[model samples]
Target: MKVQQLQNAVEAFDFDINSDEHIPELGRLIADKQVVFVKQKLTEERHYDILDSWGSPGMSPVIAGIGLGKLKGLHWNAVRNTTARIGKLIDPRHRSRMQSVTFQKDHKGRALGIFTNGKLGWHSDQPSFESAQRVVGLASVEASEGSQTTFLSTAECYDNLNCEDRSQVDELMCVNRWDMISKNVFDHFAGELIEEQHAIMRYNGCPLDGLTAPLKGQTASGVPGIHFPGSLFGYFLGMSVDESKKYIKHIWSLMDKPEYIYTHNWKDGEVCYMDQAITLHARPTSVDEGDMRRMWRCSGYLDKLYPGQGPMTMKINVEGEEITWDELFKRVDEVRKAEYNRTKWSKIFHKMP
Candidate 1:
């Protein structure tokens, strides 16, 4: 493979996500490259805003950190604490109750995968929560020694699509269901609330005027970040098996350009964050199938900013600050207080006539 280079060892949109000190804004580098490489260095906080929009159609959950970087050196409890921090940073509407899941080889009797032969097909994260999730986080707790992440940007695919294709699929929304029992999605971000009652399709935030929905993406910068996930929209449009397959293949090809893809080769002790609207992430499985790979996923969204940004907020780095596990645990406990019990309620009960 012809490894693309950048000025003075600082590369943007590189497939390899690793230890370095350069962060590149990819919107400017879309000339010949489709992806941006964000080399990681230990910092006090994370970068906010990507050319202004919180959602992304290119690569998601705006990636950062590697199992080998920031995550590698920390204790498992510390990692869990950091993961908890991610949950707190999400929007309140969706974060009302968040699920914490660990992706590990032990669960599968070996390794688990989001991409590869036995994995789910190309997909966006979290399609089933009543409270839409905007940002998603993944840390390589035990990433197979040579494993890395491959991100596909849907923005480029949306742009290259023909008018007819766009029209037919534009208004279509996806029913993103998470089959946790099947391993397609985890239970933490997949299940419905007590009030939702075994529901499958997530809510569509599209305006009453039939404007674009969250999954359809907005047309602000004049660049259509993405159409809809082909599987979901194809059914709505009544697309033929062959026809949909062709378009899906075409879009997949466009996203494969080295310039458009950010391959994250992890080093111990790092983390990555990306805009979910624009990003799609996956990774290869282990060759041995006997090695243990442990990872933790915590997410938030930009639409769901720290102070109730929406379901779209994924991670907040505490502005490069550090807090002990005990401190983090106390904060989490405070948020999900056990004081809501009936006995506690009667202490200050006020009944109406």
Candidate 2:
């Protein structure tokens, strides 16, 4: 979607996106610019308010075309390692590895589960980290001849239920260690996961069994959000051993309802980004990973976050010695300046003593 055409689409929708004003550009900016941006403009003056009502400056518009707009296709995969080369660099903070590299077949079938495939257990992303959200990007290289990227917004999910389900989740937490959840089968494991002894280290993802991220959430207009722990299955809030299992069955039964799902039919080059906070997504699989199904799926959080608290720093091991905070900060600044343009974090490697 060309930049000018994006504005035109909004105008065509009769939302009057001011052309000569100070509204921040609707989509991404840098090396990820897009040729077109698709958005549902608002007739109400509270568009930002609607977005704000969702909480934080994290709303993603479906965008097509190339350039920065293409970043939307990136979803939330802003990590720099395509080959999983940095698998060695992750530092496990617990007895279990905090993330999952994911087996191509045994688990989610390399990311394909065309409709007839049974329901995916509900869960959120990045619940293991100290952070509250993760950026998730999706680009439809192809779709099930008729399937879409189906999702259940946590807000919508929690909102649709009774005040009782909401109350049960008021003060619960789940654990995110891999060993505590699933078995480690991938031989090509990240050094950190191995060392940390994690069972399945995917963020906020719960084991198909039970066990989930500890109490994690956010506040929107004073309404609180409590996610069902992935590890513990549907038991996170108040469901019991049998009840939790039943709860899973119940939510799964509701999968076919249109009000609870937003299935995305991917455009060849278009990308979609979403705030993990408001959305829970799943793909009905297609072929298998090695077949035509192999779409490069890479996931990572920001190598450095500019959290408003300002200039946070950490010392990391590089080439056998710790890189000082001063050097790390300088490197982070350089990275932020060159954001979205640079590939490979080898520049940080060269700074090794």
Candidate 3:
């Protein structure tokens, strides 16, 4: 494949994207370049097949276990079937698209995708999870005219930090939760969310609730970078939400510099893959409702780099204490059950009145 640089990202030209021979090179390009774009027409099935070559598609079983149900002790086929059904029940349109990426609504007005006409905030895909997807791929199903997706290389940002800043970032932990409207990312710059956007926020926030991870993440090659979840960020581990905002914004400033950023204008029959572990991407431009901007998006680990490492676990920082993922999952479960009970009771009381 012929390659050329596109600002901070790289663009590949003239290659068989679907060939197994090119898959390794494609994976390496995404890792080294952080973002690699290619103009190639791909079907919905082809888009998903390319991602499957990288690793397991859709949500990592580790995160899915918390939302869908425990995936332990299930056969591989059974697990896939179970998750597919449960995932569909959670969001029907998303399930139809392989539960990989969001899309726009159809003529029937049924929410076909979570991504509507709005400017998305800067962040990696699903950074709230301990085992967040390592790579993200987006294909232009319908060219996103009049909109651009900007990407920033956090790995480069981390490398440029001074000794003190680097040390600080390494030791820091940040809390991420999606259940709260206050943490809604789409509203980062925009005003109040419309009902559809609010629903999207809830789904995005539910999978990895009240979890903490190091502010720094590493590429599979061991290059360190910022693990920013954008507006989904709740707070730092030891700092109050108000206190954490100062630091979060400060760090965000460093990454947003032009030297580390690239903005891509989409075209029909174009596909791009980005290293989610080492990059933050944004949609700074707004899309009108009538625009035919749609993409087939996928995020997962690259099998060549992260093989057979499903159902991964990590140590989570809570307050000043460190806890196992299992403990955190249990705590989240209890809180969810309690919240469900309160809502249930409130509904019953309203009927009585």
Model 2 global lDDT (CA atoms, 0 to 1): 0.33
Candidate 2 per-residue C-alpha lDDT over 1-353 given as tens digits, one digit per residue, 9 for 90 to 100: 22432210111122334341222333221102211223332222232222222223321111101112322323224322221222222232210111122222334222111111222333445443223333343333433234345555444455565666555445444333344343332222222222222212331232122223334344222223444334333343343456655654554453335665555554443344443433455554333234332121222222222233111122232222445534533443343335434433555667778
Clash pairs, candidate 3, are 54-303, 103-113, 178-205
lDDT of 1: 0.36
Better of 1 and 2 by lDDT: 1
In model 2, which runs have C-alpha deviations exceeding 4 angstroms?
1-123, 130-132, 141-147, 176-216, 219-226, 231-257, 293-353
* TM-score: model 3 vs. ground truth: 0.81
Best by TM-score: 3
RMSD of 2: 15.2
Query: Which segments of candidate 1 are over 4 A away from where they belong?
Result: 1-121, 128-131, 141-144, 174-215, 218-223, 227-234, 238-250, 253-258, 287-290, 304-309, 312-353
Poorest 10 consecutive residues by lDDT, candidate 3: 71-80
- The Cα local distance difference test for each model comes to 0.36, 0.33, 0.66
RMSD, every candidate, angstroms: 14.0, 15.2, 5.1
Candidate 2 accuracy as TM-score: 0.43
From the highest lDDT down, the ranking of the candidates is 3, 1, 2
Q: Compared with the true structure, what per-residue lDDT tens digits does model 1 show for residues 1-353?
A: 12344311124444433322222323323212323344443221222223223333211121122122322222223333333343443343332222222232223232122221222233454332222344444444444346665666666566766787566447544332222123223322222212221121221211011111233552222334653442222222344546645765665576666665656676544444433454566554332334354333434443311234353232221212334423433432342233234434666574523
User: Per-candidate TM vs. native?
Assistant: 0.44, 0.43, 0.81
lDDT of 1 at 125: 49
